[model samples]
Target: MYRTARKVAVMGAAGAIGSNVVQDLLSCGVASRIAMYDPYEPGLKGAAEEILHCAYPDADVSWTTDAAEALTDASYVISSGGAPRKEGMTREDLLLGNCEIARQLGRDIRAHAPNAEFVIIVFNPADITGLVTLVHSGLSPSCVTTLAALDSTRLRAALAQHFDLLPDAVTGCATFGGHGEKMAVFKDGIEVAGVPLAEILAGRAVNGRTMSPDEWNAIKDRVRNGGAAIIKLRGRSSFQSPAHQSVAMLKARIECSAYPWPCGAYFADGPYAHVMMAAPVTFSTLGMTAAVPDGDDEDVAALQDSYRHLCSLRDEVIRAGLLPPVADWTSLNPNL
Candidate 1:
């Protein structure tokens, strides 16, 4: 039941992450044609050549400087283009520049690949950039999403290490809200070895060592600061994990499988209106639905804080002239 002759487009396909994304998409073996778009001619050509050398008969790989050429007829689009963050910068610091990039990319997608089933935003400040893209793309919020699961995955790793267990032993780790410092890491939402983290912190010892509340707080801090830690350790922003996770999201969308990871999706109505925030969710060709967490008041408050933080960022973008006010959003894209 494989779909035939599907075209998948990768924006910023020449960069470190984008190149890896290109290869990953090829490995998926779902797309009969893979279109790569990057303005950097040398990098784009080199990436295309390297993949061509592999000679995957299932993929008809093509690179282009033309946005329309790359995007036309694409079934799904993954964008990771924009300036990379440096050591001292927060995700919000990358906002102004990256949102402009996202705005233009969205316009191109609207013009050329309006029917693209899913458009994933992966550059820094993905929540804001994702909102920018969704507004300009003239597509419904359900058709667009952003990569925000890295924080949750980082939290999962921290929990596994704290419990001295294999990573898979930790489950139900969820991160909500923005993908930056303001994200909410819900301890009650996670389990180590199928036991609640809150219970473990209360008294239960795992492997003869109990985790105190302070220890749990430290783990949350580590998850929040994980990206900066990576940049300090590696002298560059992260690429591989983001690339892999975004591609996994696309694959899930195509196969209609449940996505265990959190995704940044639009909230048009409710407490989080006019912002994009990550939440537990399911995806399909039709759209996405963010799950209401079954946790306690603390979880609700933390998620609300993250939502407010994201709203501030979104408002900043609007005020800076990057986008019109929220009232005009529907005018820009009727689908919203």
Candidate 2:
């Protein structure tokens, strides 16, 4: 349990994921106070009311249209404020608008919550949003992380189902790179009931059937496209699962869990200079500490490719004037 009472702020508290996150936070009793901000005034008020009615009536909840008002003195800031991805839309399709949203929110958070321990990005093209937030907020890359845990969770569920094992038994599974289709799922260090997953899957028949290499590829592809599949079926993007993932991450951060799961798009320096891609990270009061060197060769290669893709996307955003130039960033933070 956390000893300190902290203020948690949600930037898009009216939206599907944001409202669900608010409920999760209150239900988990993680925050002493929660400030909810949404540009849509009515939606914000309604969401707050609904949350209050459902749980934690005594919880300190505030709703606002102003980012500064919500972010003031916040310990953790979650950015879920942006347009949802439509049925036929790709994550990149939502990039420009969401990046603009994140850019302004980052500026406000920097001004209002300069000392916030973590700024979590939950919007689409999460890697880019995280990068924009890191640069615009003028915070260390370590202070920001994108919600990649959803992908990891999806992978674990899919693998567990494939092998007829419980999800908890499938441990040490990790998803790296961007939060989109390019993200890589790593089986290294993964275990099932104290047995290595690779070993268990090797020439093993499950449910009177053996999973071929092509079937494994199909499973991974399904994991990568899980969000899109949900959107296609439901006519909107996911909400509850992502909200749950966000709360889990918040719990890990607040409790200082020793075995923090891998999250998407964490800011990297040293060997992963000028990049914010998915990797294994432990959250602390200072910010996220990544285990970049823990990846196997395949993971490293996929991560580098994802990094290159993110760089290209950043360049595109810079060209559109949505974000500052690389030179400006380097000038501001020479350490990066």
Name the runs in model 2 displaced over 4 angstroms: 1-4, 55-57, 86-93, 205-209, 265-268, 333-336
In the range 96-194, model 1's lDDT, one tens digit per residue, is 889999899889998999998888999878889999999999998888999988998999999888878999989998888887678988777577887
**Candidate number with greatest TM-score:** 1
Compose the digit string of candidate 2's lDDT tens values, residues 1-336: 323368899988999999998888877777658899999999999999997787564678889998898999998988888777666877566888788888887788779988888778888788888788877887776677888787778888887888787888778877877777677677778776666656655866644545667777888899889988898999888899888888778878777886446775445456556657778887676667887736678777876776677778888889988877777785544434
Query: What TM-score goes with each of the models?
Result: 0.95, 0.91
Model 2 scores a C-alpha lDDT of 0.78
TM-score of 1: 0.95
Model 1 global lDDT (CA atoms, 0 to 1): 0.85
Q: Give Cα-based local distance difference scores for all models.
A: 0.85, 0.78
Find the 10 residues in a row with the least total lDDT in model 2: 264-273
Per-residue lDDT value at 221 in model 2: 93
